[model samples]
Target chain A: MKMSFEHRDGLGLLRVEEPRIDASVAIQFKDRFHDLTQNGTGDVILDLSQVDFLDSSGLGALVGARKLLGAGRVLELCGLTPTVDRVMVLTRMHTVFPIHPDLVTALATRAATS
Target chain B: MTGPGPIPGVIGPRPWGLTLRFAATPVAVRAALSAVDAGLADAGAPDDLRARAQIALAEACNNIVEHAYPRHPPPTEAHIRLDIAADLGGLQITLRDRGRAMPDGPLPGRELPPLDPGDIAGLPEGGFGWAILRDMTRAISLSRRNGQNILRFRLPHADKPGPLSRIVT
Candidate 1:
Protein backbone atom coordinates (compact mmCIF):
# COMPACT_ATOMS: atom_id res chain seq x y z
CA MET A 1 0.00 0.00 0.00
CA LYS A 2 2.48 2.63 -1.19
CA MET A 3 1.03 6.14 -1.55
CA SER A 4 2.47 9.56 -2.27
CA PHE A 5 0.67 12.70 -1.11
CA GLU A 6 0.94 16.10 -2.76
CA HIS A 7 -0.80 19.35 -2.00
CA ARG A 8 -1.51 21.80 -4.79
CA ASP A 9 -3.95 24.67 -5.07
CA GLY A 10 -5.82 23.66 -1.94
CA LEU A 11 -6.31 20.07 -3.15
CA GLY A 12 -4.75 16.88 -1.86
CA LEU A 13 -3.47 14.48 -4.49
CA LEU A 14 -2.92 10.90 -3.33
CA ARG A 15 -1.37 8.64 -5.89
CA VAL A 16 -1.55 4.92 -5.16
CA GLU A 17 1.85 3.57 -6.24
CA GLU A 18 0.84 -0.07 -6.57
CA PRO A 19 -0.50 -1.66 -9.72
CA ARG A 20 -3.01 -3.96 -8.03
CA ILE A 21 -5.34 -2.69 -5.31
CA ASP A 22 -7.07 -5.96 -4.45
CA ALA A 23 -7.95 -8.05 -1.43
CA SER A 24 -4.30 -8.45 -0.56
CA VAL A 25 -3.89 -4.81 0.44
CA ALA A 26 -7.47 -3.70 0.93
CA ILE A 27 -7.21 -3.35 4.70
CA GLN A 28 -3.84 -1.67 4.62
CA PHE A 29 -5.04 0.61 1.88
CA LYS A 30 -8.07 1.71 3.83
CA ASP A 31 -6.06 2.28 6.98
CA ARG A 32 -3.23 4.13 5.29
CA PHE A 33 -5.51 6.39 3.29
CA HIS A 34 -7.55 7.18 6.37
CA ASP A 35 -4.44 8.04 8.31
CA LEU A 36 -3.17 10.33 5.57
CA THR A 37 -6.47 12.10 5.32
CA GLN A 38 -6.95 12.59 9.03
CA ASN A 39 -6.74 16.39 8.75
CA GLY A 40 -7.68 16.59 5.11
CA THR A 41 -9.23 20.05 4.75
CA GLY A 42 -9.20 20.19 0.99
CA ASP A 43 -10.86 17.65 -1.29
CA VAL A 44 -8.77 14.52 -1.96
CA ILE A 45 -8.41 12.95 -5.36
CA LEU A 46 -6.91 9.49 -5.89
CA ASP A 47 -4.89 8.61 -8.94
CA LEU A 48 -5.31 4.96 -9.91
CA SER A 49 -3.29 5.09 -13.11
CA GLN A 50 -0.91 2.45 -11.84
CA VAL A 51 -3.67 0.17 -10.60
CA ASP A 52 -4.86 -2.16 -13.34
CA PHE A 53 -6.83 -4.49 -11.09
CA LEU A 54 -9.33 -3.99 -8.26
CA ASP A 55 -11.59 -6.41 -6.38
CA SER A 56 -14.62 -6.12 -4.14
CA SER A 57 -12.49 -5.57 -1.07
CA GLY A 58 -10.68 -2.75 -2.81
CA LEU A 59 -13.99 -1.21 -3.77
CA GLY A 60 -15.23 -1.46 -0.20
CA ALA A 61 -12.07 0.18 1.04
CA LEU A 62 -12.59 3.06 -1.36
CA VAL A 63 -16.09 3.63 -0.05
CA GLY A 64 -14.89 3.20 3.50
CA ALA A 65 -12.29 5.87 2.94
CA ARG A 66 -15.00 8.18 1.71
CA LYS A 67 -17.17 7.46 4.72
CA LEU A 68 -14.18 8.09 6.93
CA LEU A 69 -14.05 11.61 5.56
CA GLY A 70 -17.61 12.20 6.77
CA ALA A 71 -19.89 14.65 4.97
CA GLY A 72 -17.97 17.82 4.17
CA ARG A 73 -14.76 16.31 2.72
CA VAL A 74 -14.65 14.56 -0.65
CA LEU A 75 -12.64 11.75 -2.22
CA GLU A 76 -12.53 11.43 -5.99
CA LEU A 77 -11.09 8.70 -8.22
CA CYS A 78 -9.25 9.34 -11.46
CA GLY A 79 -7.37 7.51 -14.22
CA LEU A 80 -8.91 4.06 -13.78
CA THR A 81 -7.67 1.30 -16.06
CA PRO A 82 -10.30 -0.14 -18.36
CA THR A 83 -10.65 -3.28 -16.24
CA VAL A 84 -10.97 -1.21 -13.10
CA ASP A 85 -13.50 1.05 -14.76
CA ARG A 86 -15.54 -1.96 -15.86
CA VAL A 87 -15.62 -3.35 -12.33
CA MET A 88 -16.70 0.07 -11.02
CA VAL A 89 -19.46 0.24 -13.61
CA LEU A 90 -20.66 -3.32 -13.00
CA THR A 91 -20.74 -2.71 -9.28
CA ARG A 92 -22.54 0.62 -9.81
CA MET A 93 -19.70 2.49 -8.14
CA HIS A 94 -19.47 4.82 -11.10
CA THR A 95 -22.46 6.63 -9.69
CA VAL A 96 -21.14 6.73 -6.15
CA PHE A 97 -17.77 8.31 -6.85
CA PRO A 98 -16.79 11.13 -9.14
CA ILE A 99 -14.46 9.58 -11.73
CA HIS A 100 -12.30 11.44 -14.22
CA PRO A 101 -10.50 10.05 -17.19
CA ASP A 102 -7.17 11.44 -16.05
CA LEU A 103 -5.60 13.47 -13.29
CA VAL A 104 -5.30 16.61 -15.38
CA THR A 105 -8.94 16.41 -16.32
CA ALA A 106 -9.97 15.80 -12.75
CA LEU A 107 -8.08 18.86 -11.51
CA ALA A 108 -9.43 21.02 -14.29
CA THR A 109 -12.98 19.94 -13.60
CA ARG A 110 -12.58 20.73 -9.93
CA ALA A 111 -11.19 24.14 -10.79
CA ALA A 112 -14.08 24.85 -13.12
CA THR A 113 -16.72 23.70 -10.67
CA SER A 114 -15.17 25.45 -7.72
CA MET B 1 -27.16 -15.24 -10.03
CA THR B 2 -27.89 -18.20 -12.28
CA GLY B 3 -27.81 -21.69 -10.80
CA PRO B 4 -24.74 -23.82 -11.34
CA GLY B 5 -25.57 -24.11 -15.01
CA PRO B 6 -24.28 -27.15 -16.96
CA ILE B 7 -20.90 -28.53 -15.95
CA PRO B 8 -18.64 -30.51 -18.22
CA GLY B 9 -18.73 -34.30 -17.99
CA VAL B 10 -15.04 -34.58 -18.80
CA ILE B 11 -13.86 -34.17 -15.25
CA GLY B 12 -10.65 -36.00 -15.83
CA PRO B 13 -7.32 -34.93 -14.42
CA ARG B 14 -6.16 -31.60 -15.85
CA PRO B 15 -2.66 -32.09 -17.19
CA TRP B 16 -2.09 -28.40 -17.94
CA GLY B 17 -3.09 -26.89 -14.65
CA LEU B 18 -1.37 -25.20 -11.74
CA THR B 19 -2.53 -25.90 -8.20
CA LEU B 20 -1.65 -23.60 -5.29
CA ARG B 21 -2.69 -24.12 -1.69
CA PHE B 22 -2.62 -21.09 0.62
CA ALA B 23 -4.08 -19.93 3.89
CA ALA B 24 -7.16 -17.72 3.64
CA THR B 25 -5.21 -14.54 4.38
CA PRO B 26 -4.57 -11.26 2.61
CA VAL B 27 -0.90 -11.92 1.86
CA ALA B 28 -1.81 -15.28 0.41
CA VAL B 29 -4.24 -13.57 -1.94
CA ARG B 30 -1.40 -11.58 -3.49
CA ALA B 31 0.67 -14.72 -3.89
CA ALA B 32 -2.29 -16.47 -5.51
CA LEU B 33 -2.75 -13.61 -7.97
CA SER B 34 0.94 -13.71 -8.80
CA ALA B 35 0.66 -17.44 -9.42
CA VAL B 36 -2.24 -16.76 -11.78
CA ASP B 37 -0.13 -14.14 -13.51
CA ALA B 38 2.64 -16.68 -13.99
CA GLY B 39 0.25 -19.31 -15.29
CA LEU B 40 -1.30 -16.86 -17.73
CA ALA B 41 2.11 -15.82 -18.96
CA ASP B 42 3.06 -19.44 -19.49
CA ALA B 43 -0.14 -20.05 -21.44
CA GLY B 44 0.33 -16.88 -23.57
CA ALA B 45 -2.98 -15.43 -22.52
CA PRO B 46 -3.85 -11.97 -23.82
CA ASP B 47 -3.48 -8.91 -21.60
CA ASP B 48 -7.24 -8.31 -21.44
CA LEU B 49 -7.89 -11.91 -20.48
CA ARG B 50 -5.16 -11.81 -17.88
CA ALA B 51 -6.54 -8.62 -16.35
CA ARG B 52 -10.10 -9.96 -16.19
CA ALA B 53 -8.90 -13.23 -14.68
CA GLN B 54 -6.94 -11.43 -11.98
CA ILE B 55 -9.94 -9.30 -10.99
CA ALA B 56 -12.36 -12.24 -10.87
CA LEU B 57 -9.87 -14.44 -9.04
CA ALA B 58 -9.20 -11.76 -6.45
CA GLU B 59 -12.90 -11.27 -5.75
CA ALA B 60 -13.54 -15.00 -5.43
CA CYS B 61 -10.48 -15.57 -3.27
CA ASN B 62 -11.32 -12.64 -0.99
CA ASN B 63 -14.85 -13.90 -0.47
CA ILE B 64 -13.41 -17.12 0.89
CA VAL B 65 -11.00 -15.26 3.14
CA GLU B 66 -13.65 -12.99 4.63
CA HIS B 67 -16.65 -15.35 5.02
CA ALA B 68 -15.34 -18.92 5.07
CA TYR B 69 -14.62 -18.98 8.78
CA PRO B 70 -17.14 -18.55 11.60
CA ARG B 71 -17.23 -15.06 13.10
CA HIS B 72 -17.35 -16.02 16.77
CA PRO B 73 -13.77 -17.28 17.05
CA PRO B 74 -12.31 -16.20 13.74
CA PRO B 75 -10.31 -19.17 12.51
CA THR B 76 -6.93 -18.12 11.12
CA GLU B 77 -6.27 -21.15 8.97
CA ALA B 78 -9.13 -21.38 6.56
CA HIS B 79 -7.20 -23.01 3.73
CA ILE B 80 -8.01 -22.33 0.07
CA ARG B 81 -7.01 -24.26 -3.02
CA LEU B 82 -6.73 -22.53 -6.42
CA ASP B 83 -6.45 -24.56 -9.59
CA ILE B 84 -5.75 -22.76 -12.87
CA ALA B 85 -6.68 -24.70 -16.02
CA ALA B 86 -4.68 -23.25 -18.93
CA ASP B 87 -5.22 -25.60 -21.86
CA LEU B 88 -4.46 -23.47 -24.94
CA GLY B 89 -7.72 -21.96 -26.17
CA GLY B 90 -9.55 -21.36 -22.90
CA LEU B 91 -8.67 -20.71 -19.26
CA GLN B 92 -10.45 -21.93 -16.14
CA ILE B 93 -9.92 -21.37 -12.43
CA THR B 94 -11.23 -23.88 -9.90
CA LEU B 95 -11.32 -22.71 -6.28
CA ARG B 96 -11.95 -25.11 -3.41
CA ASP B 97 -12.43 -24.33 0.26
CA ARG B 98 -13.46 -26.59 3.14
CA GLY B 99 -14.57 -23.95 5.58
CA ARG B 100 -18.07 -22.47 5.84
CA ALA B 101 -20.74 -22.87 3.21
CA MET B 102 -23.14 -20.18 2.03
CA PRO B 103 -25.46 -19.39 4.94
CA ASP B 104 -28.51 -20.02 2.75
CA GLY B 105 -27.11 -23.17 1.16
CA PRO B 106 -26.65 -21.63 -2.28
CA LEU B 107 -24.50 -19.12 -4.09
CA PRO B 108 -25.76 -15.62 -3.37
CA GLY B 109 -27.40 -13.54 -6.04
CA ARG B 110 -25.03 -11.16 -7.94
CA GLU B 111 -27.45 -8.36 -8.77
CA LEU B 112 -26.15 -4.90 -7.90
CA PRO B 113 -28.36 -2.27 -6.30
CA PRO B 114 -30.13 0.38 -8.31
CA LEU B 115 -27.97 3.33 -9.36
CA ASP B 116 -28.79 6.42 -7.32
CA PRO B 117 -25.93 8.87 -6.99
CA GLY B 118 -27.94 11.19 -4.79
CA ASP B 119 -28.14 8.78 -1.86
CA ILE B 120 -24.74 7.64 -0.65
CA ALA B 121 -26.19 5.45 2.10
CA GLY B 122 -28.23 3.47 -0.38
CA LEU B 123 -25.16 2.61 -2.47
CA PRO B 124 -23.71 -0.74 -1.42
CA GLU B 125 -20.06 -0.93 -0.60
CA GLY B 126 -19.83 -4.70 -0.37
CA GLY B 127 -21.86 -7.56 -1.93
CA PHE B 128 -20.30 -6.73 -5.29
CA GLY B 129 -17.85 -9.62 -5.37
CA TRP B 130 -20.06 -12.30 -6.96
CA ALA B 131 -21.48 -9.86 -9.47
CA ILE B 132 -18.02 -8.81 -10.61
CA LEU B 133 -17.16 -12.49 -11.17
CA ARG B 134 -20.17 -13.03 -13.42
CA ASP B 135 -19.42 -9.87 -15.39
CA MET B 136 -15.83 -10.97 -16.05
CA THR B 137 -16.25 -14.65 -16.89
CA ARG B 138 -18.26 -16.53 -19.49
CA ALA B 139 -19.39 -19.26 -17.11
CA ILE B 140 -19.15 -19.87 -13.37
CA SER B 141 -20.10 -23.13 -11.65
CA LEU B 142 -20.25 -23.84 -7.93
CA SER B 143 -20.83 -27.22 -6.31
CA ARG B 144 -20.25 -28.39 -2.77
CA ARG B 145 -19.25 -32.00 -2.28
CA ASN B 146 -17.59 -33.95 0.52
CA GLY B 147 -17.57 -30.92 2.78
CA GLN B 148 -15.62 -28.91 0.23
CA ASN B 149 -16.97 -26.10 -1.93
CA ILE B 150 -15.80 -26.13 -5.55
CA LEU B 151 -16.13 -23.05 -7.75
CA ARG B 152 -15.06 -23.13 -11.37
CA PHE B 153 -14.78 -20.08 -13.68
CA ARG B 154 -13.96 -20.39 -17.38
CA LEU B 155 -12.71 -17.77 -19.86
CA PRO B 156 -12.23 -18.56 -23.52
CA HIS B 157 -9.40 -16.82 -25.37
CA ALA B 158 -11.03 -17.16 -28.74
CA ASP B 159 -14.61 -16.64 -29.85
CA LYS B 160 -14.96 -20.05 -31.52
CA PRO B 161 -16.00 -22.85 -29.17
CA GLY B 162 -13.09 -25.01 -28.18
CA PRO B 163 -13.40 -28.69 -27.46
CA LEU B 164 -13.68 -27.97 -23.75
CA SER B 165 -16.49 -25.43 -24.23
CA ARG B 166 -18.37 -27.74 -26.59
CA ILE B 167 -18.14 -30.55 -24.07
CA VAL B 168 -19.28 -28.32 -21.25
CA THR B 169 -22.16 -26.89 -23.24
Candidate 2:
Protein backbone atom coordinates (compact mmCIF):
# COMPACT_ATOMS: atom_id res chain seq x y z
CA MET A 1 0.00 0.00 0.00
CA LYS A 2 1.99 2.97 -1.30
CA MET A 3 0.70 6.28 0.08
CA SER A 4 1.62 9.86 1.04
CA PHE A 5 0.12 12.03 3.76
CA GLU A 6 -0.04 15.81 4.25
CA HIS A 7 -1.30 17.53 7.32
CA ARG A 8 -1.74 21.23 8.21
CA ASP A 9 -2.95 22.12 11.66
CA GLY A 10 -6.08 20.01 11.97
CA LEU A 11 -6.79 19.53 8.27
CA GLY A 12 -5.26 16.44 6.74
CA LEU A 13 -5.16 14.70 3.37
CA LEU A 14 -4.20 11.16 2.40
CA ARG A 15 -3.52 10.25 -1.16
CA VAL A 16 -3.39 6.60 -2.06
CA GLU A 17 -0.86 5.71 -4.77
CA GLU A 18 -2.05 2.35 -6.00
CA PRO A 19 -3.82 1.17 -9.09
CA ARG A 20 -5.89 -1.64 -7.56
CA ILE A 21 -7.23 -2.08 -4.05
CA ASP A 22 -8.15 -5.73 -3.58
CA ALA A 23 -7.74 -8.37 -0.91
CA SER A 24 -3.97 -8.14 -1.05
CA VAL A 25 -3.85 -4.58 0.28
CA ALA A 26 -7.25 -4.24 1.91
CA ILE A 27 -6.06 -4.81 5.46
CA GLN A 28 -2.90 -2.85 4.94
CA PHE A 29 -4.85 0.06 3.50
CA LYS A 30 -7.19 0.21 6.46
CA ASP A 31 -4.43 0.06 9.03
CA ARG A 32 -2.26 2.60 7.33
CA PHE A 33 -5.16 4.96 6.65
CA HIS A 34 -6.33 4.90 10.21
CA ASP A 35 -2.85 5.33 11.59
CA LEU A 36 -2.20 8.30 9.32
CA THR A 37 -5.46 10.09 9.99
CA GLN A 38 -5.87 9.09 13.59
CA ASN A 39 -4.67 12.40 15.01
CA GLY A 40 -6.33 14.77 12.57
CA THR A 41 -9.13 17.20 13.20
CA GLY A 42 -11.78 18.76 10.99
CA ASP A 43 -11.98 16.84 7.67
CA VAL A 44 -9.60 14.33 6.11
CA ILE A 45 -9.95 13.87 2.39
CA LEU A 46 -8.75 10.60 0.95
CA ASP A 47 -7.63 10.99 -2.64
CA LEU A 48 -7.89 7.88 -4.76
CA SER A 49 -7.18 9.26 -8.21
CA GLN A 50 -4.80 6.45 -8.99
CA VAL A 51 -7.01 3.58 -7.88
CA ASP A 52 -8.53 2.00 -10.96
CA PHE A 53 -10.06 -1.01 -9.25
CA LEU A 54 -11.50 -1.77 -5.84
CA ASP A 55 -12.99 -4.96 -4.41
CA SER A 56 -15.14 -5.93 -1.42
CA SER A 57 -12.19 -6.10 0.92
CA GLY A 58 -11.16 -2.59 -0.01
CA LEU A 59 -14.70 -1.37 0.53
CA GLY A 60 -14.81 -3.07 3.88
CA ALA A 61 -11.53 -1.50 4.82
CA LEU A 62 -12.80 1.95 3.99
CA VAL A 63 -15.97 1.41 5.97
CA GLY A 64 -13.97 0.05 8.86
CA ALA A 65 -11.67 3.03 8.77
CA ARG A 66 -14.66 5.30 8.94
CA LYS A 67 -15.94 3.49 11.97
CA LEU A 68 -12.54 3.58 13.58
CA LEU A 69 -12.52 7.33 13.26
CA GLY A 70 -15.48 7.52 15.65
CA ALA A 71 -18.06 10.28 15.30
CA GLY A 72 -16.12 13.48 15.90
CA ARG A 73 -13.73 13.46 12.97
CA VAL A 74 -14.88 13.34 9.37
CA LEU A 75 -13.21 10.94 6.93
CA GLU A 76 -14.47 12.33 3.66
CA LEU A 77 -13.31 11.06 0.27
CA CYS A 78 -12.29 12.98 -2.82
CA GLY A 79 -10.74 12.47 -6.26
CA LEU A 80 -12.14 8.96 -6.71
CA THR A 81 -11.07 7.44 -10.00
CA PRO A 82 -14.01 6.62 -12.23
CA THR A 83 -13.69 2.91 -11.58
CA VAL A 84 -13.26 3.39 -7.85
CA ASP A 85 -16.06 5.93 -7.74
CA ARG A 86 -18.43 3.55 -9.44
CA VAL A 87 -17.92 0.86 -6.87
CA MET A 88 -18.42 3.35 -4.06
CA VAL A 89 -21.69 4.53 -5.55
CA LEU A 90 -22.86 1.04 -6.42
CA THR A 91 -22.39 -0.14 -2.85
CA ARG A 92 -24.15 2.98 -1.61
CA MET A 93 -20.97 3.89 0.17
CA HIS A 94 -21.48 7.38 -1.10
CA THR A 95 -24.28 7.38 1.43
CA VAL A 96 -21.87 6.74 4.25
CA PHE A 97 -19.08 9.14 3.33
CA PRO A 98 -19.33 12.53 1.71
CA ILE A 99 -17.75 12.02 -1.75
CA HIS A 100 -16.43 14.99 -3.64
CA PRO A 101 -15.51 15.19 -7.29
CA ASP A 102 -12.06 16.49 -6.43
CA LEU A 103 -9.92 17.75 -3.59
CA VAL A 104 -10.87 21.36 -4.20
CA THR A 105 -14.54 20.60 -3.65
CA ALA A 106 -13.79 18.57 -0.58
CA LEU A 107 -11.80 21.45 0.87
CA ALA A 108 -14.44 23.93 -0.22
CA THR A 109 -17.08 22.05 1.72
CA ARG A 110 -14.91 22.31 4.76
CA ALA A 111 -14.34 26.01 4.22
CA ALA A 112 -18.02 26.74 3.77
CA THR A 113 -18.81 25.09 7.05
CA SER A 114 -15.96 26.45 9.13
CA MET B 1 -9.22 -20.75 -30.43
CA THR B 2 -8.99 -22.46 -33.70
CA GLY B 3 -11.15 -25.55 -33.35
CA PRO B 4 -11.26 -26.45 -29.69
CA GLY B 5 -7.66 -27.59 -30.06
CA PRO B 6 -7.42 -30.77 -27.95
CA ILE B 7 -8.81 -31.40 -24.48
CA PRO B 8 -6.41 -30.48 -21.66
CA GLY B 9 -3.86 -33.28 -21.01
CA VAL B 10 -5.07 -35.50 -23.83
CA ILE B 11 -3.17 -36.66 -26.92
CA GLY B 12 -1.92 -33.55 -28.73
CA PRO B 13 -1.26 -29.95 -27.73
CA ARG B 14 -3.73 -27.39 -26.39
CA PRO B 15 -2.37 -24.09 -27.60
CA TRP B 16 -5.44 -21.99 -26.92
CA GLY B 17 -6.30 -23.28 -23.45
CA LEU B 18 -4.36 -22.77 -20.25
CA THR B 19 -4.74 -24.15 -16.74
CA LEU B 20 -3.10 -22.99 -13.52
CA ARG B 21 -3.19 -24.09 -9.90
CA PHE B 22 -2.44 -22.00 -6.80
CA ALA B 23 -2.18 -22.44 -3.09
CA ALA B 24 -5.24 -21.20 -1.22
CA THR B 25 -3.62 -17.98 -0.06
CA PRO B 26 -4.28 -14.29 -0.55
CA VAL B 27 -0.99 -13.93 -2.43
CA ALA B 28 -2.22 -16.34 -5.07
CA VAL B 29 -5.05 -13.98 -5.94
CA ARG B 30 -2.86 -11.51 -7.82
CA ALA B 31 -0.79 -14.20 -9.47
CA ALA B 32 -3.88 -16.01 -10.75
CA LEU B 33 -5.58 -12.86 -12.02
CA SER B 34 -2.46 -11.54 -13.77
CA ALA B 35 -1.97 -14.89 -15.49
CA VAL B 36 -5.60 -15.02 -16.60
CA ASP B 37 -5.45 -11.49 -17.96
CA ALA B 38 -2.28 -12.29 -19.88
CA GLY B 39 -3.86 -15.40 -21.28
CA LEU B 40 -6.98 -13.51 -22.29
CA ALA B 41 -4.87 -10.80 -23.89
CA ASP B 42 -3.16 -13.47 -25.95
CA ALA B 43 -6.60 -14.69 -27.09
CA GLY B 44 -7.73 -11.14 -27.99
CA ALA B 45 -10.40 -10.98 -25.31
CA PRO B 46 -12.32 -7.74 -25.34
CA ASP B 47 -11.80 -5.14 -22.63
CA ASP B 48 -15.32 -5.56 -21.29
CA LEU B 49 -14.88 -9.26 -20.57
CA ARG B 50 -11.36 -8.75 -19.36
CA ALA B 51 -12.56 -5.99 -17.04
CA ARG B 52 -15.47 -7.91 -15.53
CA ALA B 53 -13.63 -11.19 -15.32
CA GLN B 54 -10.95 -9.44 -13.31
CA ILE B 55 -13.45 -8.48 -10.60
CA ALA B 56 -15.62 -11.62 -10.71
CA LEU B 57 -12.61 -13.91 -10.59
CA ALA B 58 -11.13 -11.94 -7.72
CA GLU B 59 -14.27 -12.42 -5.72
CA ALA B 60 -14.34 -16.11 -6.61
CA CYS B 61 -10.69 -16.68 -5.76
CA ASN B 62 -10.91 -14.69 -2.56
CA ASN B 63 -14.00 -16.61 -1.60
CA ILE B 64 -12.03 -19.80 -2.03
CA VAL B 65 -9.25 -18.50 0.17
CA GLU B 66 -11.55 -17.20 2.91
CA HIS B 67 -14.17 -19.95 3.02
CA ALA B 68 -12.51 -23.07 1.60
CA TYR B 69 -10.26 -23.69 4.55
CA PRO B 70 -11.87 -21.87 7.42
CA ARG B 71 -9.45 -21.57 10.35
CA HIS B 72 -9.25 -24.98 11.91
CA PRO B 73 -8.77 -27.46 9.08
CA PRO B 74 -6.00 -25.67 7.23
CA PRO B 75 -6.06 -24.70 3.52
CA THR B 76 -5.76 -26.50 0.19
CA GLU B 77 -5.09 -25.66 -3.44
CA ALA B 78 -7.20 -23.99 -6.12
CA HIS B 79 -7.18 -24.48 -9.89
CA ILE B 80 -8.11 -22.22 -12.80
CA ARG B 81 -8.60 -23.17 -16.43
CA LEU B 82 -9.07 -20.60 -19.18
CA ASP B 83 -10.61 -21.98 -22.37
CA ILE B 84 -11.37 -20.02 -25.50
CA ALA B 85 -14.08 -21.31 -27.77
CA ALA B 86 -13.44 -22.81 -31.18
CA ASP B 87 -14.25 -19.65 -33.13
CA LEU B 88 -13.05 -17.31 -30.39
CA GLY B 89 -16.64 -16.29 -29.78
CA GLY B 90 -16.22 -16.23 -25.99
CA LEU B 91 -14.14 -17.38 -23.05
CA GLN B 92 -14.83 -19.84 -20.24
CA ILE B 93 -13.10 -20.00 -16.87
CA THR B 94 -13.36 -23.02 -14.62
CA LEU B 95 -12.12 -22.62 -11.05
CA ARG B 96 -11.60 -25.82 -9.12
CA ASP B 97 -10.87 -26.32 -5.46
CA ARG B 98 -10.46 -29.30 -3.16
CA GLY B 99 -11.72 -27.45 -0.14
CA ARG B 100 -15.17 -27.05 1.35
CA ALA B 101 -18.34 -26.27 -0.54
CA MET B 102 -20.25 -23.05 -0.18
CA PRO B 103 -22.03 -22.81 3.13
CA ASP B 104 -25.44 -22.87 1.44
CA GLY B 105 -24.24 -25.43 -1.12
CA PRO B 106 -24.23 -22.64 -3.73
CA LEU B 107 -23.74 -18.94 -3.83
CA PRO B 108 -26.78 -16.96 -2.87
CA GLY B 109 -28.63 -14.74 -5.34
CA ARG B 110 -27.91 -11.48 -3.59
CA GLU B 111 -28.85 -8.06 -4.90
CA LEU B 112 -27.12 -4.73 -4.53
CA PRO B 113 -27.40 -3.32 -1.06
CA PRO B 114 -30.58 -1.37 -0.40
CA LEU B 115 -30.66 2.39 -0.94
CA ASP B 116 -30.22 3.82 2.52
CA PRO B 117 -28.57 7.18 2.29
CA GLY B 118 -28.56 8.89 5.68
CA ASP B 119 -28.40 6.18 8.26
CA ILE B 120 -24.83 5.18 8.96
CA ALA B 121 -26.07 2.18 10.92
CA GLY B 122 -28.01 1.09 7.88
CA LEU B 123 -24.96 1.47 5.60
CA PRO B 124 -23.37 -1.78 4.50
CA GLU B 125 -19.75 -2.64 5.03
CA GLY B 126 -19.59 -5.90 3.04
CA GLY B 127 -21.62 -8.42 0.94
CA PHE B 128 -21.08 -6.80 -2.46
CA GLY B 129 -18.77 -9.41 -3.99
CA TRP B 130 -21.20 -12.06 -5.25
CA ALA B 131 -23.46 -9.37 -6.63
CA ILE B 132 -20.51 -8.04 -8.59
CA LEU B 133 -19.81 -11.48 -10.03
CA ARG B 134 -23.41 -11.91 -11.13
CA ASP B 135 -23.75 -8.47 -12.70
CA MET B 136 -20.38 -8.42 -14.47
CA THR B 137 -20.38 -11.83 -16.10
CA ARG B 138 -22.88 -13.13 -18.64
CA ALA B 139 -23.24 -16.60 -17.14
CA ILE B 140 -22.10 -18.07 -13.84
CA SER B 141 -22.57 -21.52 -12.29
CA LEU B 142 -21.21 -23.18 -9.18
CA SER B 143 -21.33 -26.85 -8.28
CA ARG B 144 -19.63 -29.67 -6.45
CA ARG B 145 -18.46 -32.46 -8.67
CA ASN B 146 -16.68 -35.62 -7.51
CA GLY B 147 -15.64 -34.06 -4.21
CA GLN B 148 -14.26 -31.02 -6.00
CA ASN B 149 -15.81 -27.60 -5.83
CA ILE B 150 -16.18 -26.37 -9.40
CA LEU B 151 -17.12 -22.84 -10.40
CA ARG B 152 -17.32 -22.16 -14.10
CA PHE B 153 -18.41 -18.94 -15.73
CA ARG B 154 -18.44 -17.29 -19.16
CA LEU B 155 -17.56 -13.87 -20.51
CA PRO B 156 -19.21 -13.56 -23.91
CA HIS B 157 -19.34 -9.80 -24.23
CA ALA B 158 -17.67 -8.02 -27.16
CA ASP B 159 -18.54 -4.36 -26.58
CA LYS B 160 -17.35 -1.54 -24.35
CA PRO B 161 -18.41 -1.15 -20.74
CA GLY B 162 -21.84 -0.04 -19.64
CA PRO B 163 -23.03 3.02 -17.76
CA LEU B 164 -21.88 4.25 -14.35
CA SER B 165 -24.61 2.28 -12.56
CA ARG B 166 -23.08 -0.93 -13.86
CA ILE B 167 -19.71 0.43 -12.84
CA VAL B 168 -21.11 0.54 -9.35
CA THR B 169 -21.41 -3.23 -9.67
Each model's fraction of native contacts? 0.60, 0.52
A1-114, model 1: which lDDT tens digit per residue?
A: 899998898888999999888876888999999888887698899999999878888888888787777667778999999888877777767767899999999999998998
Candidate 1 residue pairs in backbone clash: none
Best-performing candidate as measured by lDDT = 1
lDDT of 2 at A84: 73
- Chain B, per-candidate TM-score: 0.75, 0.73
- Tell me the DockQ of each model, to 2 decimals: 0.43, 0.45
Best by TM-score: 1
Query: How many Å off is the CA of B142 in candidate 1?
Result: 2.1
Q: Write the per-residue lDDT of candidate 1 for residues B1-169, one digit (tens) a residue.
A: 3322111222222345678998788777888788878766555456777777788788888887777754634466678999876654567789999987766655655666455666655556687887777666766778879999888888765534333223223
lDDT of 2 by residue, B1-169 (tens): 3633432222234445667777677667787788877766655555656666677788888777778766633434444443334224455668887777777754565476665645544556778887666655656787888878888776654533434355555
The candidate that achieves the highest DockQ relative to the unseen native structure = 2
- List candidate 2 stretches off by more than 4 Å: A112-114, B1-17, B72-89, B104-106, B113-115, B158-169
lDDT of 2 at A100: 86
